[model samples]
Every structure is written in structure tokens, then in C-alpha cells.
Target: MSRLILRCFAVATLLVPVSAFAQFDIEREPINYLKGPVSDPISRLQMRLDEAEVRLTFDLKSGYLESVLKTLNVSETSQMLVFSKTSFQRNRINPRTPRAIYFNDDVYIGWCVNGDVVEVTAVDPQLGGVFYSLDQEEVDRPKFARHTDTCTLCHASSVTQGVPGHLVRSVFPDSVGNPILSTTTYRTTYQSPLKQRWGGWYVSGTHGQQRHMGNMIAKSSREPEAFDVDAGANVTDLSKLINVEPYLAPHSDIVAFLVFEHQAPAHNALTLANYQAKLALRDEEILRKMDKDPDAPRTESIQRRLDHSADLVLKHFLFVEEAPLTDRVQGVSGFAEQFAARGPHDKQGRSLRDFDLQTRIFRYPCSYLIYSAAFDGLPSELKAIVWQKLHNVLTGVDQSSTYQHLSAEDRLAILEILRDTKQNLPASWRK
Candidate 1:
């Protein structure tokens, strides 16, 4: 087994409760239902779906649709099967066009088929339930379907030949169905996309300092050559860099906010609450030093722009918070509650709410800089307006009251800050 798989098993073993071992029961009855052996094509399809669900009960690993034949004492020739939730349509004009289906596990399963579901069945292996098809149903056009090509376009990035599924790298905890830390070339062989971009190893264009490790480790450190903007060395130039857009936008917003709040100059904040103060102070210090030494390593222009970018990010966050929740930006608490009440599968086979919360929450750190920068870079007129609004809300809260008791306007102002910070990021910052 790979190290990642081993690690998962180890973690699972440790976390499994002793009661779980004692509760294991091999004699439990298998769930069963029947559909199909139908003459009509549409009827046959619906029957297939029903049979798949029956088989899935015995192999419940969450969102995985198992084949009835695979779980039963049947030969490979047995026809029972469960189609993946996603499928592709061939472009009539282009036979070479690629198509695929993405499973909940992030595996891509490719196939071509026409028409909607027709029949369904369920079977009980433990009880030996008989197989039969339900009445035929008319095909209805599907309202939503993701193209197979879209699946391959992304999955092609981390596919392993020997592995059954695509390698998905995630920071969340892994369950039986979802592997949190799958093996990937990016981690073991190729440089980690995150590290490569953030560590400043590769400068994008000719506009910045050259301080890569090779120069730092040399006996006589020398500046690396200016980045080739035309060739695209920095992350800004690399479209394939993972999560670059979302990550950078928020990062800039946070920086911007810090610059505005603290009016300090340093990039690093002394305290979380005082981040803005520190950045603003740092900017002032840099400007002062530059006056004394014209050839200083840091340039005033860069510092000013960084501050401006930070301000813009903060403004965007505020805007997002104020906006009503659409398909995106649903609050974490609300989403979790909805997921808890959902049936076996969401509309998309996978639970949309769970996926959104898990993926988006984990990626928050990626955008911290953008958010900071947005705050710092607000236009002078807007800065005064935001600052005053914030001040009034903060002052309005009584010393005796907790944050939960704050008035709606006060809450709205804070939401505005978050929304604006999220929404106003420049096109370059978007994914």
C-alpha cells in the first residue's frame, strides 16, 4: 500500500471505538429490491437504476453506486450494473472529442449513452430476493448535466495509472469514501504547487526581488536574474497553479485591511487584531528610509501598490457579506444544517452543501493576503466612509452586551466588510 493509504488505515484504527468491533455482525440481512428484464429500452434503464440502488445498500461507502452483480454470487457475464451519476454525449461532428464522468470519490468514469432513466430494481442478497423490472417510464430531459470533457480537463492533472481513482489532495479529514491525502506527483516527485508559488522560488515578471534559495545558500550570495515576464516565471503567470486566484485575492484583502487599520508599514502583523496597523506603519517606515537611502532594496511604488491592492480586497469582502446568499456564500452553519437533513444523495449524487463547505473553508487561508490588500487599498473617499461606518457600529455596542446582541445595522456593517472584501477582487485575483 502507498504511504497515504497506510496513514489512513492507521488513523482509522486509532479512531475506531472498541464498541464498534463488538457490534460487528456478519449475519445481518442484505437489503433487496427488483426491477427490469424489461423489453422497452427506457424501462430497462430505470430497472437498472433500481437494481443498482439495491446493491448499493450492501456496499454503502457514501455516494458510491455499487453494481448488484459485483456483490452477488454472479459471473462477470451477469448484466446487472449501476451507471455513474455523470456521463457524456459525443459531438456528432468530432469523434475524437474526449468525454468523462466524475464520481463522488473524484474518479473519472467515461462512457457514452443517450436518454434518461427508464426502470429500477432492488435485491436482497442475504434473502435471495427475485429479480424483476418495474413498469416502463417515459424519458424526461435532464435539466442539468456537466460535460464529460470538463471532468477530464481537471482530473488529467492528478491521475495515477495504477490507482483506481484520481489523486485528490485535500486538507480535510478523510472518511471511508473520501481519501484526504492521496498520493500525488506534486507532493512526492514534483514541487508542491502551493509551496512553489508562495515560497517566492519563481518570480513571475521582471518587477520584483530575486531571493530564491540558490542565491541565499551560496557562499557569496548573488541576486538571481530578474524574472522573465515574457517567459512567465511567477505564479501570476502560471494558470495551472492550484487555487492561485482564490488564495491571492483574499490574501491581498487582508493585507489591505491591515494597512488601513494600523496605518503601519510591515507585512507581518504583531497581533491578529492589529494587522492593519502594522502594515501601515511598515509602509511609512519604508518611505522614510527610502528618503535617506535612494538605492534601498524596497521601492516606494511597490509598497504603495501593495497597500492599494489590500484596500480593494477588503472592500470586496464587505460587498459579499452584504449581498444575499445565492448558490454560493451560504453561511457554514446553514449549509451544515441542510446537509444533515438531506436524503442519501443530493441532486448531484454528491451533497453540494458538504462539498462547498469543506472545499471553500479549507481554501480560506489561500486568499488571506488578497483580503488584507483589498482593505489597505480602498480609495481615499471610500476609506473615510468605511472607517466612519465601522467606528459608529463599534461605538454603538454597549459595554454590557455581547457580540450576539449587537443591532442589525452593526451586524450588517460587518457583513458588508466581509462581502466587499470577497467580491471586489480584481480579475487577476479570480480563479
Candidate 2:
């Protein structure tokens, strides 16, 4: 099922040992994730609502969902539906009544039919994915409360690289929408194979001869592998499977699903990089103070941390190991056109958002999220390392095997596009 920061119910049955989780000192020091001030879109909107600077009109059916999406600038074309009971309001979610998730570059909104509240996750500049919930009650000025306790149990786990972030999962679901924990569940990403993706979700697209685990359900938990995948393949209409009148859109566009898959981990990587770099620098400063040195250069330990963090960011940013499509994929919804239209194109009119859909997700393998606030908000030291490595790879200086997927033409086009579209790029990048 699709999610913003909700726990994957497939993994919910298994209790993870505390030692297995990577602990980041998020509560104290420079990266005070809990006590820190947040500048995420939801928090900004909350402030406006508090001052009556803006108004959110409520409707009977969807409550404040439509208004919240409008106020946050989240597009309805970015909608995707999930049928699995994997969210906070699991009792209300099923194959008959799925949760509709809408998102943009910076924010994600989750709404289930007849649910109590609208779940939200906004990407903060430093804190990564900040969770919130707007009550579905009919009040003059509805409030959005920041959530940390339950949301963080999954959001800040190892799946999100020990940072507050988002993830997309694919799980085998039963008739009632509960994920069959006995079956193989995948933490789907840009790297996930098409066949292994979209389980327990409603995917509306046409991918010729390429089968995925969507728009279908498992008959018996004991025989999860006996699913008739062909029955669910290349599904264009979802009306027969479930009633679509309650949702904002009639289709849960495959293009939107693909983009969502890619965006979640990319945002996580950015968040991890930001958090790790900040924490590393803070540790270095503490060590320096203990040593009584005011002008000590950064230690190797700190540099290593920065290097590791940068690698994580670059790996996703560069689309290392992204799954290739066997055939041309098409989405019925206008998401593909609308997504490509959000372009900071070069003189050649090429954008990072431009879809490939034939062999890969993007024509230029570089992520469009490089222009995201999370990327832009990275620590200067960390960003410097990232830029240098990116330049080396794009300029053909570092032809290591990790980036072999990027052809010469691909590298050149991406480099030129970044030079034209991206701002504050390093001087070496321009050259």
C-alpha cells in the first residue's frame, strides 16, 4: 500500500529489536528534531490558519481534505489509491474503501473514506518528514496538530535511513485489506522491479505484457504465491474492482505511482544526508572544544561521515540501480503531461521531469529532486562534497562502475541541463 510516513503492516507483526535500529540523537543538540522549530508547509499553513490569514472551507463528504490540498498547492493529478489496511485508520480502509493519497514535491496528504482525520507529512528543510493531522470535524477553524509518537515509530526507522522520512511499500493483501505477512513484502522504490511493485494498491495504467501486483487481492494467506497476476496486469479501468466516486480522481495513474515511488526514497536520502552531516559537524565541534583548538580542520571521522552521507544522497540522486521497463508504459491520467510541464528547462527545452517510460523512468537519469528544498537546504560542507562528486561523474573524470548505467550522452545532457536550470551550482559544474 502507498503511504506518506505510516508503518508497513507487513512488518508490523514482527517486533524489531531496539538494538537493530540506528539511533540518531535527534532530541538534543543542533539537530533537535523534537524541540526544533519547523518551517514545513503544513506548519506554515497552520500559522496562517491561526492568524486567520487564510481560510479552509470544509465540504460534507471530504471534510477539509479538498481545502487542505488547495491551500498547500498539492495537485489532484498526483493522486494514488491504496487498499491495504496499513495506515493509522486501518479499520476504515479495505479493497472496497481505499485511502487516497495526494502529494507534491514538499508535502503529502492521506485521506481515507469516512476517516477521522487527514494525515499529512511535510518535508522540512532540516527535520525531514514532519508528521501532522487535521481533524475532519466541522469547526470554524480546524487545527492541525504535529504528531511524533506513533508516526516516528515507522517514519524514523531503518527503512528511512534512521531519519524522519517517507517510504512506499508493496505487500500481498487479503480480501479485507490486511497484508499477508507470510508473503514477500517489498519496500518499493525507484529500484524496485515493475513486477514486484504496487501490491495492495490500485494502479491504473497500460504496461504491455509487463505484469504488476496491483488491482488484485490474495485469496488465501497460506497460498499467497498462487495469485493470478495476469488478472491484474495492464488494468486501465478500476470501476469494477471498487467504486471510484468517493475519491478525487477516477484513476490512480501509474505515472503518478512511479513518480511517488521515486520521490519517497529520494526525499529520505536528502533527509538522511542533512541529518547525518549536521550531527557529524556538531560532533566535530564538540571534539574540537574538548581539545582546546579553535581553528582545527575537520577530522577524518567527520569527513568520513560527510562522505558516507553524500554517497547515500548521490546514489539516489543519480538513480543507481533504477529498474528499467521492458515495454512502453502509459498512464491514462494527465499526470505525465502535468509533471513534465513543471520544468526548469534549458535552452533545449529538456527537463529532469521528462519521462522515458520506455526503458527507464527518466530520460535523463538525474533526479528532479535536486531542485527540492531538502537538497537546497543541505549543509554547505555536505553540498560541496556532493557537487564535486557529481561534477566528476558527469565530466567523465570518475568512470567507476557504479555509474555505468549513465551513458556518455546521458551524462552530457544531464550536466548541460543542470548548468542551465539549476541555480547556485558550483563553478566546476558550469565548466
Clashes (backbone N, CA, C under 3 Å), per candidate, total 110, 0
Q: By TM-score, how accurate is candidate 2?
A: 0.94
Error of 1 at 421 (Å): 19
C-alpha TM-scores of all predictions: 0.18, 0.94
In candidate 1, how many Å is residue 206 off? 52
- The lDDT leader among the candidates is 2
lDDT per residue, candidate 2, 1-431, as tens digits?
44422223322312333223256767876789999989999999988988999999989889999999999988888889999988989999999999999999999999999999999999998898999999999887889999997999888888776888897889999999999998799999989999899999999989998889998899888998688999998888889788999988889999999889889999988887787778677766666665578788876656777888888889998999999899999998799999999998999999999999999989998999999888999999999999999998998998999999999999999999999999999887755
Candidate 1 lDDT over 278-346, as tens digits, reads 333344454445356645554444344344434433333222222111122222112224322332332
Worst 10 residues of 2 by lDDT: 4-13
For model 1, what is the error of residue 130's alpha carbon versus the real structure, in angstroms, after optimal superposition?
A: 47
Q: Total backbone clashes of model 1?
A: 110
